[model samples]
Target: MVTAALALCVRTGAGAVIAATVFLTVLSVTLGGSVLADTPLWLPAMPAWPLTATGARLPVALVLGALLLTVSTGLAHRELSRAASR
Candidate 1:
């Protein structure tokens, strides 16, 4: 899901958003795994959100990210197509 968002964002030339999404996704995965492993690292414990709540948040974030990327891509594609016609 995150990967699809990243790809769409990159396709739209939104470097900042793409970078942010990539960073967050990596951080989320790393932290999630570390927490699950019960590592003694000083990192903060994952928040106590319920499983269903956490699950719900993920799809929302992914959808929002995808929408932003899709809009950006559409705009970029329109510009490129227009330019090509000139």
Candidate 2:
């Protein structure tokens, strides 16, 4: 997710940095294998503290996806602005 965000940021202004940070952090946690188990697909389940499970990773992935989409949109807008300025 962070990679996508970085790509987006490359075109967009620095405004995307916050979103990138949030996404990358969440992704790192998820990929680290520390989250709740048996979480429903629709809801963000709060995993028990100090627990580790694949189910817990879903929320992080979802958040990261959202961040990626947002950053990509921003990048598109930035590119458009640049083109218009030229």
Candidate 3:
């Protein structure tokens, strides 16, 4: 997704960024994972605080969020570099 957005931006302009941002925001809000239950898909899940009110799942959320952000950042960085080069 990041790569596609970067490619589009490189080819086009900031519109790609807005479109991609909207798409990702929608995707995350609609399809984001939940740590409260086990999902069949490997996609990240938003954590359910009701199930983990004791703060046990806080670490899980933090770790997963960090991991997801790290991966996204790396991919975005690579794509941005590629876009900048062109």
Best by TM-score: 3
Write one digit per residue (lDDT tens) for candidate 3, span 1-86: 45546556666688868976776556455544344243422243333322332356567666766776677667667767877797
lDDT of 3: 0.55
Candidate 1 has a TM-score of 0.34
Q: Cα RMSD to native, each candidate? A: 8.3, 7.6, 6.0
* Residue 78 shift from truth in candidate 3, angstroms: 0.3
The Cα error of candidate 1 at residue 81, in Å, is 0.7
lDDT of all predictions, in order shown?
0.49, 0.52, 0.55
Candidate 1 vs candidate 2, TM-score winner: 2
Supply candidate 3's per-residue lDDT for 22: 76
| Candidate 3: stretches off by over 4 Å | 1-54
lDDT of 1 by residue, 1-86 (tens): 33445444545557766676667556555654555423322122222112212543556545655676687667666666665687
Candidates in order, TM-scores: namely: 0.34, 0.36, 0.45
| Cα distance off (Å), candidate 3, residue 71 | 0.5
What is candidate 1's CA lDDT for residue 1? 37
Once superposed on the true structure, which residue ranges of model 2 sit more than 4 Å away at CA?
A: 1-54
The model with the greater lDDT, 1 or 2, is 2
